[model samples]
Target: MACLVRSLCDSQPVARFQRRCGLFPAGGAAGEQYVVKNYFYYYLFTISAAMGQEVFYITFLPFTYWNINPYVARRLIIMWSIVMYIGQVSKDLLKWPRPCSPPVVKLEKRTTAEYGMPSTHAMAATAISFTFVAVTVNQYKYPLELGLMGAFLFSTLVGLSRIYTGMHTLLDVIVGSLISALLTALVYPTWDLIDHLMLNSPLCPAFCIVVPLLLCYNYPKLNHYSPTRADTTTILGAGAGATIGFWINNRYISDALAEAATHHVLSVSGEMLLTMLAKFLVGIGVLVITRQIIKNLALKSLCSWYKVSINDHKALQQFRIEVPYKFITYSSIGLNSTVLVPLLHKLLGLN
Candidate 1:
């Protein structure tokens, strides 16, 4: 208990440096000096963190599952993958220490061990919020004010939450937000072009899957203290899976849906709502099962082939074992999202 208190209360080197540089107030316990000590701020930031989590984003999966808009679904998948890839690559390359580390701000979440120059949370929030606004307002003809205001408020709160939690500095938040904005602007315009080039071509899906895998395989090595490779692998795998799934859907499922439009799966609003709920439940269940099975199989096969015990952490550290496992698992998820779920809905006469 004493040690835990010391860890929480002691001034980190980064905090001290920030104090010297006038970024923070000098001369008190880290918590005492920071505005985050207030209960309101703490709770607010905590909620913001939760909002930026991957699981929170999964709520948007129903949009795709219900076939609300295929274009929107595709954009969501691609945007998520791109933001994660860029944010993680930047984190690894910059190798900046998190404010929570010793000689930085007091650690809020001890399990957080990654570098934190530009916070991925901030970047993701910005990317998702911005993309949502752009899609809804410009493409879907939603009210610009409503879309912009909501996205701006959400993204701003998420960015501020990072600072309040001592997870990122002001500069980190700014950079993260800017990176998202820039990427969204560039990528949004190119979506139509990419669809034109890749959607109809037989060879394009193969290229998409191979290229991302190759990139992950040859990803740059970290020069400083290394974080787990699991995050990167997951992103790559999901991207690959989405790529393949998009192709399959574009070629097969989409055409079938168009032709089946006259079939009239649901005749009333209540039935449509019920069908959407059922699809969400069933689709998510399949996705979870697929992810777990692939992860276990990959781990077991790799362990056996490499002559290493599954429990041997030190031995596993020497191998880039997570790459294949994450790729397969997330790809299964992506493929399931775009192809399997839709097919099931059709076969069940729900859509």
Candidate 2:
């Protein structure tokens, strides 16, 4: 990724520095080539956050406001924090210099970057977008196609911002977005499972063992497919439910969290835990009253939004399903799922 970015910086749309002979230093780059390069990289940087802000704001946060709950909020916030932390670590571990000055991007000022691969903004934004949408749709209900489009727009603009500000090469931002997104995707759900284990270990083993079996039992009658297909559908269903749950929780936090911020008597950790616990209580209550629509919604329903059939084995790996993106998925799942699920079994928390 770094090499690709360097190549881009050196080759196409190269931003000429001050010729190492300028009388005064410049804060921004100048020239159309540099502008293009930066814009491309910036787009890479802002993706997840951009997508997250839209889904979370329009779907999750507003819905939470209308409902007025906080347990979901706390969990969502913690998860978001996790995603943010992952982005930070990835940035440093990757240790690419900022493509440019990391400026407040504008139309002009094509600043050159020092290290430009894997734009942090892109990673963070993408994480936020996925986590927010994950929580929202997983938890509540929303228009699907329109929602995805909106998320895409937000992420795209964020990526563009990187370039407009001359903060990264196109390759840098693109690679960054992909790296962050892929990494997050692989990790978060596993995190949720780990959380579930730590919080509810005894039941987790049974739950993990049973859900798939039960899903297998009903696999044929519910949809009637082969083991491979049945397994795929079940996996999709669980994922869909998790995403929905994630969204419901995230939406509540994005808006109401600010209010919780006002009640900042405790440290960040205390406040987060207390607030999240409160949210969990609220979610439980809501589940009781709504007959657990948010809690029980099927991935089949979610799949309908994307025109994915429950039995479509290819879709799980191929289609752009709107999975609920929580912060834990970015951090915990990244670490836990692959290591355990492949070797032992997979369970769930909020992934």
Candidate 3:
């Protein structure tokens, strides 16, 4: 087990695996002194990275399913998508290089090929932990002191991990944490107002869809290379999906599910557990299939319409075809998670 952990912690093996997963650049400059060779730091940063992963957040969905109140789930999904979009945009606009091997420490799992300013990992950790604690304290009447303590500890570890691994400068982590805190403070109070407007306004869908696309279109031009196009498309697609799904849920699903829950007696723990398991299985399957189909179709259609060959990597990147493709795919995922998945639950008599 120790050997396996060491092997997995090795930079070359982990980096190669990440590259094959299409999550990192194929090659990057390497250096000896700057690399985090200490096994202890390697494991720590690896765990830290996993904590900040999108998949970890997705696990909260099942809890929402069990509770029958998706308020927290929806908020988390929307907040994460927006935060990532903002972080990626800022990184691209700044176009700052990450801590390279010669001058600074380089860590393993350096998958993202984007600029390093205001570390997204730090931002995401702070945003998620802070938002979760805030919601729990405000809505659920949980103890504020305990929530704040836990959140502070988690966010601190995540921020420290970035610096320890040499993935970001101290300033980057500080800025990232501050940005997340500021955004949370501003958005939390206004979310209800925004949610009302989005649900009621006819222009909600159009606004949500168009605004993100416009943001992508107007992204700052940078001479140096960055994953600007890919990152923009990912968030835009997710934002669009979440927007459409939220609208659909407000129109069709939320009230019905609430009514059904009130009408029916709560199930026993065993039954509830089984239902949750089934819901997760079904929901994940549908989401995976929907994402794959939409991504393929969107890419093919966009390539043909732009009169660019799919194989022309340079043209695709230059024209930002990834924007539309990711938009369609993530939108489907968002829609599936909110609208279709609940409807399926109802059909299956799980809710």
Candidate 4:
């Protein structure tokens, strides 16, 4: 893949086109443009991740590259279930032939004991490509034409690599790419709604930084998961409840107490510190009660209405830092929330 792309970057025709377009100004330096371009496409991961963890793809080119967010792994997991698992099961049921064998190549042992029908890596890469599309097209001003061309070409190459590695057939890779693209189309609408809605508020930090993170860290599904619409709603509710409780406690409750203490319309004592304590407790009580009701409703919505799986204790579990750095890796697993969380934070100001 790198070879073809790198070769494309070095092509004389492409160089001529760039020169004609004035995109490769002589002042920009020669010879290194293609190398830099290839670096951006194939090796931009050097500093993207947190400190301490790095990796490199030893392709025809053999240098370490930084790891993409762990959440990409999560996204692949979900994508695989949709594309690989379901597709593989369908083939088993229908008895599809293997490409390597007259029937199929001998199935390889997977680390997690999962079967392959469609290609997981292919689906995941395709999903990431779609998300990059949503980010450039829907979230940012990056040109859609270039973004899509890159995404499609990149996804295709990644898919093909799986076939060359004997992990999947060409048919499996194609189906996986289709599955990812389809899932991206299905989810991004709801995903975009969350992104464009709450980015600028004081709670933007909570939605973007806190919620997606907290959800992903909580893991049994919640851990390492990014914030969802349900999480955003709860954050909004909690923020509102906190704001209101603060106003009521500070303005009314405090004044009311001062009046009782001094028998005046309003009075604040120097020594009545316990009263402030009481007010603070009341505010916390309001927050807790409201949060509980919201959590219950969220659980009910998933369990009763949507029939989605619910990890009831997800919110309370401790995040594992096992292989400690893998935590960052795991968080990048699911692009559903990944694509939504940032755009939600950028476009909406719920705080």
Residue 308 alpha-carbon offset, candidate 1, angstroms: 1.2
Between the candidate structures 2 and 3, which one is better when assessed by TM-score? 3
Which stretches of candidate 1 lie above 4 Å from their native place?
Answer: 1-43, 65-67, 100-111, 138-141, 223-225, 254-271, 317-319
Candidate 3's residue-wise lDDT over 1-351, tens digit each? 987544423344433322232333323465433323355655765677666655655455434533545655556655776777788888877876665543333554433466777778888888878777765565554478999999898888887776655566666777888888888887888776776775667787898789888877777777744565666666566656766776766776667542222222344598778877888888878877887899888878999989988888776676468667777777777767777887887888877
Compose the digit string of candidate 1's lDDT tens values, residues 1-351: 987534433336336434443343334654434433345555766788777765665556435535465565566667777887888888877876666533354425532567776777888888878776665454454578988889889989888766655677666777888898888888988977775555577886778678777877776676533443567667667767766776777777667542222121324587778888888887778777887888789888888988889888665544367677667778788777777877888888877
Per-residue lDDT tens digits for candidate 4, residues 254-323, read: 3321111211122446543454444333333433453355455544454454344456445322223211
**The best candidate in terms of lDDT:** 1
Q: What TM-score do all the candidates reach, one by one?
A: 0.80, 0.38, 0.79, 0.33
Off by over 4 Å in 4: 1-114, 193-351
| lDDT of every model, 2 decimals | 0.67, 0.41, 0.67, 0.36
TM-score ranking from best candidate downward: 1, 3, 2, 4
Candidate 2 vs candidate 4: which has greater TM-score? 2
Q: Number of clashes in every candidate structure?
A: 6, 52, 2, 42
> Could you give the C-alpha RMSD of every candidate to the true structure, in order shown?
7.3, 18.8, 8.1, 19.8
